[model samples]
Target: MLRKVLECRRCGYRTVCGRDDLVARLRIVGQLRRDKDPDESIVEALLAEYTPLMTCPGCKEVGLKANDADDEWDDDGDWQAAVLCEICRQPIDPERLEFLPETKRCTECQHKSETGTLPDEDPEFCSRCGALVELRVSRGSGITRYKRFCTGGCRGV
Candidate 1:
């Protein structure tokens, strides 16, 4: 387990590891959390409560979600802006950020439309640039046609 800290700039939420033998201990807990024991229920309950993060109690109260990173600003020396993709909710590829700078979809999710599958968003041209728009569809009796590419463009990137 590599050491990493996840701090939310939105609500001061912070999850720090290796603060106490974190790596070595986390390795063992993975298996035990799967055991069919009563404690396993507790583990699931706690994890469900926190979801992606453990907790700082106060931070959860403010509802400073990971999505809030869209308006993200650095809160401190170590904390940086959120880089999670709006579509897949995963870390946007650092390389994509290098190229597009404002990419909100992970590469896989972004390419879904390219593969002829429409994403959940409405079809329209990219708001920033009138690039080749993602394909949106309308189903028919025996075929599908382009309703439009969902709204918005390449994010001016």
Candidate 2:
């Protein structure tokens, strides 16, 4: 039977058995060709290879992978995945790319958010004291309720 093969044009790699083939071939290639140790995580190896794949052509620094919906691929090969900025090790959801790289008002602006910040908020910087407004919450044990607070010197002011 002729199966619909998924081909990665940038690397000239083809897959017919979905993620399984990609995972298996990556493991073998890593071990034999790359001479990577067997103790290494295969999934991590696969991810490393996948990052440079065609998704962001010539831009290996930023990459995305499609996460499995209900533990499987979507009908159109579209699903949400963890977005990784390889240069900064900052991860965000692929679906919600609120701040892409190389933007003037991007959250990456040091005047705003620091490195390793999740791409959620724009990060408020206190104009009065030049301090960033950060909120920290701690959860312990089982079944904890949600609470909110304003961090830094912004409390009760």
Candidate 3:
């Protein structure tokens, strides 16, 4: 299973795709490797020909390049270099990023969002962390409805 990314030469749009997934419908399934067989040339060509059609609606090949997507990220402390918190615009600390690299909030903001008491008024997501918002609505006897977050479970960290 080779995980890769395809970059569009026209617009530079990138998308993650697996080699197996890309070649599944290409009619070449018996070329990867067997018990102790050596690498095959057909498999290599199929992987190299992975096009940008996986993400687009139609076929397009302006020069689809295959790159190891997994190689883009590592736990080598570089991803934590510097990023702005989407909530309070605070600089993220590299030390804290070791665990929560995708966090969009600082420690304090994350805590507030978890407790469901974020300071921002009527925040759709976490006011401090900018988490996903789960919208909820209830129906009454006849016709009673007003857009609102039903409860604290509406937002997730």
Candidate 4:
């Protein structure tokens, strides 16, 4: 069975886990805390307590500089599972992966296949900064449209 695992982007450190392991951790957390905030979820509490303790083992071994001001060691970003689309071979958006972990295609590819449309092949450049532009696809009222914007926040300029 496929299971989600956290991998450090820089150091290639990985923490393998399964549903059983998560259930055990959740049980332990439940036992440790009796009075939790009504609004705070058990998973949030578990993450809050566990995030501080997570340090990349590979980063520690290689002596990489910690990004945090506190003694906690970490890279610029949090360790997360890097999910790539089977069609595009690009990193799938984290929000999309969070909702649909089994997705094989990215938003653009998925929309193209569903609507029988192809994305523009020619590269677009930003007018203000001359950087490569990215295409954003939007669908509304049974219509699909593509919008181009600069990657370097030059659209406002």
Report the alpha-carbon TM-score of model 3 versus the true structure. 0.29
lDDT of 2 by residue, 86-143 (tens): 2343443443365453332323433335654545544454444434555554588787
**lDDT preference between candidates 1 and 3, better one:** 3
10 residues in a row with least lDDT, candidate 1? 63-72
lDDT of each: 0.45, 0.40, 0.52, 0.51
Q: What 10-residue stretch in candidate 4 is worst by lDDT?
A: 62-71
Candidate 2: where is the Cα deviation over 4 Å?
1-71, 76-78, 93-96, 99-157
lDDT over C-alpha atoms for residue 90 of model 2: 44
Model 4 regions more than 4 Å off: 1-77, 118-157
Residue by residue across 35-71, what tens digits does model 4's lDDT show? 2322224444554455334444467432222121222
TM-scores of the candidates in the order shown: 0.31, 0.20, 0.29, 0.27
What's the candidate order when arranged by decreasing TM-score? 1, 3, 4, 2
lDDT of 3 by residue, 81-134 (tens): 245455654566877787887777888888888899887633344433434344
Minimum summed lDDT over a 10-residue window in model 3 is located at 27-36
RMSD of 2: 17.9
